[model samples]
Target chain A: MSEFVEQLALCVERGKVNRESLYPPDLHGQDGTDELAKQALEQGLKPDTILEGCILGMDRIGAKFSENKAFVPELLMAAKAMTAAMTHLKPFFQSGAVKRKGTFVIGTVAGDLHDIGKNLVAMVVEGGGFEVIDLGTNVTTAKFLASIEEHPGCSVGMSALLTTTMVNMEGTIKAIKEKYPETLVLVGGAPVTKQYADKIGADGYSPDPQGAVAILNKKVA
Target chain B: MTSFERLQNRMVGNPVDRPPNFDIMMQFATRHIDKPLRDYYLDHRVLVQANMAMLNDFQLDIVQAISDPYREAFDLGLEVSFPEQSLPISTSPLLREPSDLARLTTVDPVNGRRMHDRLEAIRLFREKVGGCTPIMGWVEGALAEAADLRGVSTLMLDLFERPDWVIELLEFCCEQAILFARAQMAAGADIIGLGDAVASQVSPAWYRLYALPYERRIFQAVKNSGGIARLHICGDTTLILHEMATSGADIVDIDWMVDYQKAAEISDNDGPAICGNFDPVKIMLQGSPEQVREAVINCLSIGGDKNLSAAGCEIPINTPYSNLHAQTAALSEYYSMA
Candidate 1:
């Protein structure tokens, strides 16, 4: 990694939110992701290089979470730190300078009002440089279709926490496939299983936010 | 041996004629018998009748009065939305900002809407069948109650953004839970059921820091209040099983995703009994009677006869009657032979 990019990645890994924030116990009172990203940009680091660093840091955290070395709280801290850095690269993204790998549209399927899992996936995926369109909770099939129409060629993810609402995932998957046969759909939740995903005809199923990132990366890479 | 004797014996880890079966029932099913959701939770008569229905209808060994986690949250002044036949959910969430804690007041269990309702239910259960069946009182574990108070999203963020605030909130919730558990024991609950489903969402480290201490405190409080404590977390808790076993509960109810054999291995302590690992949906809600029997047999095989029972989480509200019979039938067959 480039020296500037490596510094950016370290800031994210350590959850250095900004120059002013005091956290992580170890890194208190130090320059954080915000200052490092700005410095990287001023030093003429390419936007893609900075973006790659964020992705690498996020991936490392994701793997740690999957392995049980880190928890949701730590992952959220990393994601927050990555978001802080990404803010510096926003202008580049807007000006067509840094391109996102693909678009991912996600929501908690109809009848399920829970959004924690869905929101976590959205945050982690956004950190991975994907244009994420979050539809929020209790999303109906019609609403999902509308999102797909608005962002054509976007991959879709459906989530449900309640067992009763999990049935709605099947309906949403069917509706999306019938209307847009080519659109890839993913499903997940506490009650959702790989078997249920296969039975529902979804293209993928991830048990955790990191798994979702891996699936999205494989699809768009 | 009678179901009551069997369960009592198992509770102390004494040798039983055979393993007993216990299941946590959902309050939403009370609506099927014409009781409103809130009324079923509030009225002692309604709570007793509903639980009695479960015992008489399914021959369950233990009966519990559990409504929803939103009860404490609602009494804490959070807005809650209650559907006709579903669990009540908090609308506003308690932890919008760290400063919101100062504005929040602790609810007295006697005067609180949700806690009082649960207490009334426990009282009714004791009056109706105190000696015949074990009655379980319910409280949300610190993590789950905190999630209900703080929206799940904000709590997840707080875990990252504000570690100190998370610790403070969990401590406050634990203090409240001890008070709640004491009141329930006074109202005649034999066992206190601690619901901490949200803890399953976090990794083991977060669970160890934010959940385990509070759970141990609550469990110790329940025991000190002259009631046995049962911990019921509804999700895949495999990752945190070992830590959870150390919470000092008398019974640990395992959800569908956790293998009972794995839980038994992790629980290493001999005091707390392991209660379940069946998939309520697959076997109880939508399976044939034979399949249900087979599933119970499988669960029992994995759980073993010592300090084990039948159930996963809250038995699904819409589980088929015949499938439920199959669960009892399997239990009866096993115990009768023993």
Candidate 2:
């Protein structure tokens, strides 16, 4: 990696968004991922290089999260940092100068309003260089199918916090499989288990956000 | 001995046959009475009837009137959405802005709409079950209530950015918690279940500084009012076990993520009496009776005499009846051996 990419990656890993951001107090008054990514671009650094830096940083944090070495706040801060870098790259993506890895549509399933878990997964996956289409909470099976149609060949992730709503995962998974048999369906949440995932014919299940990124990466790879 | 005596005796170090089993059950109880969950939770009469019926059928020890965490927030002038088939959720936080705390006022449990509903549930439980069963009243702890009033994500970031705002919200929460718990005591609740499930989101150090002090105040109020306090924290709490023990509660209800071995070590024979540590979904809801028996036996050995048997958190509504019975049925196996 180039010097600029390495610095941007370090900023994302340390959750430094910009000099004005206050989350990681030790990094205060420092140029964060937002500033460094823009500077790197201004200096003619490749957009792909900056994106790879984000992927590298998110991979490190995602692995840590799966090991329970990191908590929600750390992951959120890291995602925010990645978002800062991604904002500078968005114009490149729209101008066809950059290519996204793939689309991953995610949502908290019907009758379940909780979104923190789903939001975390979306952020980490986005930082992994995927274009994430997040359909917010209380999403029904029809909404999921529509999202899949909007982003064909996209991997789908469903979350449900309540045990009552977890049962809905089965129908959602089955419907997606019925419509797009080749599409991957991922299920997770507080009440979701590997056994339940297998029972519902889900392609994968991850207890944490990092694991979700790993699974989505694997299936697409 | 009555269920109340069994628990009360355990509280004061009196010998009891075994540790009493107390669980927070609303969805599970509604399944027993065949009422829609919304119906059961909306009316104190339905909530009381469904709980008593579940206690009798499951052979559990407590008749608890605990519902969702949105009750107190609802009474504080926040709109709570009631889905016909799911638990009630707060649609928007009561304190969206820091200055909004000025508009907030302490709620009178006897006259407040949702708080009064819970009080009536307790009084009705007292009338019907009397001293035969221990009745528990539910109150959201400072951190949990603050999260509800200001939205969870907002409150979490506030802890890092605007901590003063979080503290002020918590102080306001303590005001409502005292009134809620005290009214339940006057209405004949044997214990107060202080729920701060969101504390699991932060590290033990953060919990100690931001969450624990306010919890200590609420527990002190409960103890002063002659009502025992039970601290219930849901989700993975392995890191915060020691800090959680300092809340001055009589019992700490743990979740599955913290096994009984960790609970035993954290308690160190000095912490609050420990109850639960079983996976509500995996062990009680989906597992067979034999699996339930095995888990109970394992928990008993790990807990020794200071443990109570319960699901890690709220018992799921879809949990099997045989699995529920096995929790109590296996207790006999442990008692006979001892």
> What tens digits encode model 1's per-residue C-alpha lDDT throughout B1-338?
67668877776656676677676676435744668766665566776787788778777777777777777777888888777655565667666888998787778899997788888888888888887888888889999888888887678878767788888888888888888999999999888989998888787777888888999999999988878888888777888888888998878888988877888775454746788877877767767899988878777766654545555776666677788778888876766655
Clashes of each: 1, 0
- Native contacts kept (model 1): 0.47
Best by TM-score: 2
Instruction: Report residue A192 deviation for candidate 1 (angstroms).
Output: 1.1
Off by over 4 Å in 2: B12-15
The true-versus-predicted C-alpha distance at residue A171 of model 2, in Å, is: 1.5
What's the CA RMSD of model 1 in angstroms?
2.4
* Root-mean-square deviation of every model: 2.4, 1.8
lDDT of 2 by residue, B51-165 (tens): 8788778777898889899878999988897877788877777787888999999978877988999989999999998788988998999999988888877787677667777
- What is candidate 2's CAPRI-style docking category based on DockQ? medium
Please compute and give the TM-score of the first chain of candidate 2 against the native first chain.
0.96
